[model samples]
Target chain A: MKIIKNLALGVSFIMSTQLVSAASTGTTLETVSPEADRIALQNFYKKRFPNTELQDYVNGIYAVDADSRTQWEDIEAFPPYEFDVEEGERLFNIAFANGKGYADCFENGGIGIRQNFPYWNKEEGTVKTLEQEINECRESNGEKALKWGKGPIAQISAYMAWTSRGKVFDISIPDGDKKALAAYLDGKKFFYSKRGQLNLSCANCHVQGSNIRIRADLASPALGHTSHFPVFRSKWGELGTLHRRYKGCHQDSRSNPLDMQSETFRNLEFFQTYMSNGLVVNGPGSRK
Target chain B: MRKLTTSMCVTGLVALLATSPASALTVEESIAEGKAVYMGKSRGNCISCHQINDPDANLPGNQGPPMFAMAQRFPDKRILRAQVWDATKNNPISIMPPLGKHWILSEEDIDAVVEYIYQF
Candidate 1:
């Protein structure tokens, strides 16, 4: 009788533990209903961060009001917006070393370009960001690519961001596309990967429990950052593209910034932007 | 009759000149002076990080905020002046050097630049 009681208790404990773990990891669309999927995500975040606040959207984008929140009015007056767009336009029209202009590369004349960014490429088995696509176009055309985070490419990107002002971020992860799933998973891995001199991951500054300080300013969450690209930086005296801001963050972390149009950066952008899918685009924003 | 017309024309010119305030410079003159200051020739050389010019100029930098639509953003001249003079006091991480604290400009120079920015 005693042995049977002990065995029953052990089995019950094991079952409860398994249930908790499954709840935290969430389920793929194939395995769970939409409502269940949302519950799973909520459970996962709640389990991982018991104290942090959580918000959800249908588009998968999440805005985590970071520590320091700057009003839109305050940012609108930043000085960088003064010249970034003009400079960007100049670079866009200029011929690259291979004699191709930025306008010649895109499908829609780059008008709705931001909408399709951070896409999954099945052929390459990877994610491609706007920056990577731009650089790749330059390389394929036999032109010397601009150094990442520097020069004409960055300027053009800033211009693209400026043009995308007020547009809604519309990215979707289609069902049953294994490549897209893998790409998103890769993005998630990148988000949690810790690197740089500070040993920080993207999650460190964006997620709860990580305290970010710049002099005295509070750090806003990374969730909504993608929606406010081509930001006018008061320090830069012009508008800056998303990748340019990424480079800045990299530099701040004491890590060498990737090229402005590099594959890694594109993947990061894809992940970052997808995370901000539902937020309204507000480009040419000002930042400190 | 011709003499009378000439006199009327002169009177009109004088009235036009007299009606305009001496302190209120035209937008073109203010932008020109601001450009000079931005290029580092005037009392305040703001070009170190700021790229100030129309799109035709093509010079770009990433160190300071753009100057477009300043009037719409900060309608109050006093708030704008305080921000220019001491941004760090408002937001500590602000990289902008305090022009007022550094004595980079006399009070008159600061006032002129502030006025010019307001006009923008």
Candidate 2:
């Protein structure tokens, strides 16, 4: 057993030397195989624990005791990827007693729904976000209403975010429609607008001051803020939709938080999502 | 001349009394105590936003600046102390609440936080 241990140590030393030489010479080392890597790791642990299994060695090296990352993954897969989609599909298909389903409300059976959402609605003369669409669907159907921030309707929005995960965000108010264009402009203004008791705008932390160390890590940009949604917040211990997050932000800003499906929130989403055009949606982000 | 000599004698006695063995708190001890106050539940709760030098602490918020880099930014202890006392006074738009004015921290606690931050 002593001889075997000595042989392993000698082999590991030779392997490390070769790795260093290869790295310096910009050449690959044939001796540095996966088996060698495993053996080297095994030797390292042998010094700590004389008789631990390979599985145990790997597990000890790469162990993450917390479920924060997993929870975020689950949140990103919510709605379409989880049971929430089935509920949304049910709501989408169920016809009201007045013989109307969401299909009757929208011209496209909600197809291309993701494209035009967070868009300035020329007919309504206001911006409409996905959350508002859900509420509107409920109200038009004469169904019992779900409170904007609280219930299954928000979950359905999460489902929409999941379904639209890979779809590029494309929201444009036509130039010819000046009224709608003005609404879009208002959204843009809001993005840069400084409010709250702090007198800080979203731009302060996310745009001009990004990468500034806040406690431990740098702040991220607001450019792609809307790309992640239906995110699982560890603080909340549950998956939350984009509007729910908006409510949290408002509270953080010390502003009167808007209703979950309010027009202001929808417009804000529209503006925020428009800024995130072309970015791949990585929903269900984890944050400290 | 006698009165002048008596005054000098009294001054010498006062100086001797003032020089009696005095023990002052070290900066490190003050910092450690301040860190405890910051992390304590009823006090600053600063761990919610600010990351400390301690490596074991997890999940520090990105809402505020990290305490580790503060020494590099503000070299003067007095300036740093004032900043911690009331950030909004420096930048009117700052979201950070004033620890001193708001009664979020006691004077000793603030001094300790200042000492800790200065060491960082």
Among these predicted structures, which one has the highest TM-score?
A: 2
TM-scores of the candidates in the order shown? 0.51, 0.60
After superposing all C-alphas onto the true structure, candidate 2 shows an RMSD in angstroms of 17.8
Q: Which ten residues in a row have the lowest lDDT in candidate 1 chain B?
A: B55-64
Instruction: Tell me the TM-score of model 2.
Output: 0.60
- lDDT at position A87, candidate 1: 82
Candidate 2 per-residue lDDT, tens place, B15-111, comes to 5446521225576677678778777656766776666677645666545666665645653344566666766564544546567866668677888
lDDT of 2 at A201: 62
Cα RMSD over interface residues, candidate 2: 24.0
Q: What is the lDDT of candidate 2?
A: 0.55
Tens-digit lDDT string for candidate 2 (A16-129): 321211122211222212223224333443443444443221121111212433543454454333555556566667788888777677646764455456777777888877
